[model samples]
Target: MLDQNTSAQLKTLLERLESPIEIVATLNGSDKSDKIKELVTEVAALSPQVTARFDGTNKRAPSFGIAKVGEQPRVNFAGLPMGHEFTSLILALLQVSGYAPKVSDEVLAQIKGLNLTSDFDVFVSLSCHNCPDVVQALNLIAIYNPDTTATMIDGAFFQDEVEERKIMAVPMLFQNGEHIGQGRMTLEEIIAKLDTGAAAKDAEKLNAKESFDVLVIGGGPAGNTSAIYAARKGIKTGIVAERFGGQVMDTMDIENYTSIQKTQGPKFAAEMEAHVREYGVDIMNLQKVSSIKGADETANGLVEVTLENGAKLESKTVILSTGARWREMNVPGEKEYKTRGVAYCPHCDGPLFKGKRVAVIGGGNSGVEAAIDLAGIVEHVTLVEFDTKLRADQVLQDKLNSLPNTTVIMNALSTEVVGDGSQVTALKYKDRATDEEHTVELAGIFVQIGLLPNTDFLKDSPVELSKRGEIVINERNETNVKGVFAAGDCTTVPYKQIIIATGEGAKASLSAFDYIIRSGQ
Candidate 1:
């Protein structure tokens, strides 16, 4: 199942095995089963520490399980682990063979302390860039705790199960046969869900921390850059975010960042987090700031940040890097059918609607690019644009127009997402030119409208904001508040590129430092 170069690479990676591993396969007299057998046999031949056995009673045929010798299999694969999932397969092998995972000590302890028995079945697509994170996270939990078991099921290979469960998105997780979550989720998020008391404990710990010299709110590219810059000044810097990596985690590919030719979103976010850690920046992930009080509004003359969990933190200066999120259509049935048929990330969820008709909402670059990409997978793509003309670049519009399976509708506004209480069946729109309404039958709707700044928490705060709800900032990225600064998509920046966000973050950090020095704080 692996090529020459792949086999050599696998052989080299397997040399790190600390103990013997057994690959047990459950197969039948089918082509897929035969392929699984060959894959397991080949993998076994790569290392003396690995052995293959083709006798098992798993109901899912053409499946395999990896485990250390004489131990129950903790991680199982229901289909061929190739494409984006090949890394998952390798991680499972090494982790099950007594190799430690690359997680923090606290996280490792939490996984090992879990005493309950739980089963996780993650449905994924091979082309999805976000699937590997969920797959590898569950595998790590399964390896550390013998009571937990995780199975990575490729949705493409198991179409019957996918349809039966009505799974319309990739990386959908089901715990003990009950739906839990969907889309991109990190290992920390998975644990936070499993551990009920984790949030309260984290809040208590955060409340007990001392005041920081520079405290950054949000964990996107801007927040990470701000924290790194502030920490490099030898100041006590702490960053709190709802989720590290922000919306970039949902992004698939990023090629616009200069110096780096191309990189995936999750990989780039991981690199950013690693770089921030090198500067000793206090990183707090999975924390949501409910509100902020500037030094002018606080009794102690210190910038005060409040968490959703009632945890209060004080800082000398604050940098607001809270980024933006995908704007919703706000029409009926959109919320009810989210992840059922309404998806935001095309690259992650497009494979789930193979050969089915779908609609792309928006006429800009993202929308046209999604339609063009989905044309090859889905039966037909209908691009609905509210504008009179397509706003995408000339080349992108030309390519989209050339696609035979794609249709573009101009001056149309999406009215409602029609669904049958489970999944979407059609979309309702109105023609601006004739006041006529229309409906298009489709299996999925991809919303790429625009972005809304994540600044609702600051609506009542002292920081000045623009009419569009974006944080208003001057040339130096300084907010109207004396000690507060803003940057990135949350600010009134013209462009929302990643590189621009980083530069703005650096400027905001420097501005905050200057404020601190001038004010003798």
Candidate 2:
């Protein structure tokens, strides 16, 4: 039961409520407990102005049903209602009840088709928040793109997935075919690549496949470093990506990435790309790599690279830097209107939704970052998560709470994305506490939940795979497959950072050179 202090706090929060609010009752093991009933009644009495109901089976939760105000507001609670729990629940209620919450329509337009298909995934690091702009940008795009939904998985949380995808850096994206793209890209840039240009969309898919000296698949920090190193070493290096900048680009500010104290993912990615140009590396942006197969060992040990565009190439070594993807809510209409109101990658698309209202999925660090970032870029930022509490550290949680424009909702799952062909206008989610469903109006959505690996390209290969699906490699950065070296997020490198990737890339180059020399290539 909530103490007087807690109940009083809830009452105080309700005073500002202009709309209806849901207050589901907490469910306990007891089926015939009067205590639960009394608790529910007490809570309702405390916030008579706001709505209060029970959790599972008509039992009273502190806050469950939507209020009867002008707008029905709903807040969810998955677990028992206690300490600091009410804060999250209460905030969600207020957000759902209110309208126009100081958000901009332009920003809302950017995030129209979020909650689309479960195709898109974004990965991010803790230390890579550039003024919270990265999260804002992603929130805008997630609102619109439904076929390719967006999510921000924790770089450290998904260890097995990271290893499997060889993710050695933060802020990456993983799409279907296990093809990964890293770096910071604007919504326009991301959509352009995913849309499939003339070559990739209309051409015949390559079955046999070709190869390259350094076919750095994926364009995250690790892949970027691999390309830079390969190019610098005078080897034929090519960076193929759905777009550039990988997941790092999704991060607005990067304080932990070495050399640069504070840098946005997009800027960092552009600089890295520029540096690679100095070394003459081939950057195949907006290209799709479909399959991979081995070639007969030539005297020069040539590898083949086949593209979805029917283009092919040959090289001596291959570097796999394919990244990861984000998890989804698996709700209705999520796949129907992608990119219309739904988005991921707050940094790339947040500006488009400036002064607009948006919703963020997930309660982890990435979600926290998104809310904080979007608060600055958009008029109002709504953070939604199924977890009972935020998974982010205390400092991050505190920062999120302090943001005036940010409202966090816990113990809720989006059930449907309501909108038409052009964009998303509202969101419907289920309250885990009371099992009641409610809908709220919003312009955009951003998903920052979790990640999935992008290693489908290596399924048939002889490269030794770990149980987690990451490529097994020695400290030297050479893969079990000869002349086929892997590095960056594509390898099971211990650390994921720009500096670390640069070192690994350098190490990989040296190893590749040694193999070439020993084989007399």
TM-score of each: 0.99, 0.55
**Over the stretch 194-228, how does candidate 1's per-residue lDDT look in tens digits?**
89999899989999999999999999999999999
Worst 10 residues of 2 by lDDT: 71-80
Model 2, 400-419: lDDT tens per residue? 88888888788997889888
Clashes per candidate, residues 3 or more apart or on different chains: 0, 106
Candidate 2 residue runs with Cα over 4 Å from true position:
1-213, 231-236, 295-301, 325-328, 347-357, 376-380, 420-422, 431-438, 460-472, 494-496
Which numbered prediction scores highest in TM-score against the true structure? Answer: 1
Query: lDDT of each model, Cα atoms only?
Result: 0.92, 0.61
Question: Against the true structure, whose lDDT is highest?
Answer: 1
